[model samples]
Target: MPIKTPDAANPCVFISAEDVGKVGTETPQELAGDLGFLSNMEMIRQAGSFRMGVTPDIAAAKQMQSVPKVAIVAAPTDAKIQSGKVLLGTDVDLVVRMISMQQPHRAVPITGALCLAIACRIDGTIPARLARATLNTLTLSQPSGTIAVDANVRYINNTPVALSGTVLRTARLLFSGLVHH
Candidate 1:
């Protein structure tokens, strides 16, 4: 069953390793390697469409509808960090990369991070399987440094429920401007 917050405006979609094959042919590790040299967001979008077995139009529509935030949670792989200064440690449980229609194709937003944290706590998802016992937080290793999310999951009748998730983000006010449409 796909778990979603009942009243969420844009609910997160969690795809496990097994079900990921239904959505995309390439795994997260494979996509990471293929995306190594590509900088164009359009090309990345096309690749994602091909892997997900959807036309560009259909993918766009789906991104607008059912699953806006799609994440692939897989077992950790040896990936170069953002600076190329260091490789990720093997202790990292799972690596996640999200694709969304509302933001840049390659960027990981706070919503994606929170979704991954919630997915990590769910009982049967790949992330939950790979997650280590780390108290109440799940550490996600992205291209940048690790992001830690504080998750509180409560279970009712043996089903897990996500009560709340929190992630600390650092942002700078780049340019405050008004857009005149």
Candidate 2:
């Protein structure tokens, strides 16, 4: 589903689980590097995950207007990357984790929403713990906390359609600078 008002921040982008590129592992340093300063995506460890020694790059959260489209998921084999943290990312239009550098590990709801949407799809593309909890509600293990995203896909002759696409995102926010004073 697409965002209304172009001012909201839930469901940043939607893509089928099977559409992501090959998966990859992220080094602790890599996940902590300066990212999302505007374009580069990065992660912030959950408060619980961070207590186990996950470090977040607070410096990278610059004045950039774009939120991340990246994700750090927990595949079955990805129980722990460092300390007690599970940081597995995909070549998704993923949102690098929107973890805050400090506090309760605040994260944007859209990331959790996006991730849960991927796992809850009817397709079996993502085989993981999160993928198994699709009874109705999905519990997303975000760095800050857990979030649940409910989705409904309208099938026209068995084909899934993206209602809003990315036009609103680019046209209203990303491209605002080009057209706005």
Query: Highest TM-score among the candidates is held by which one?
Result: 1
lDDT of 1 by residue, 1-181 (tens): 2222342223445455344342222333445555432223334444444344443454453443324455555566565655554435464656665656423234357777776777677787666876665665566666555676767778999988889888866689999989999
lDDT of 2 by residue, 1-181 (tens): 2122221133232222223331323333444553442122222222222222222323332322133233444432232333556634221222223333321123435543543464345354332333544435444443433344544544578854323211111124444334556
Question: What is candidate 2's CA lDDT for residue 20?
Answer: 34
Where does candidate 1 clash, by residue pair? Answer: none
Model 2 vs. true fold: TM: 0.37
lDDT of each model, Cα atoms only? 0.55, 0.34
RMSD of 1: 9.2
Q: Find the candidate with the highest lDDT and give its number.
A: 1
Candidate 2, overall lDDT? 0.34
Error of 1 at 134 (Å): 3.0
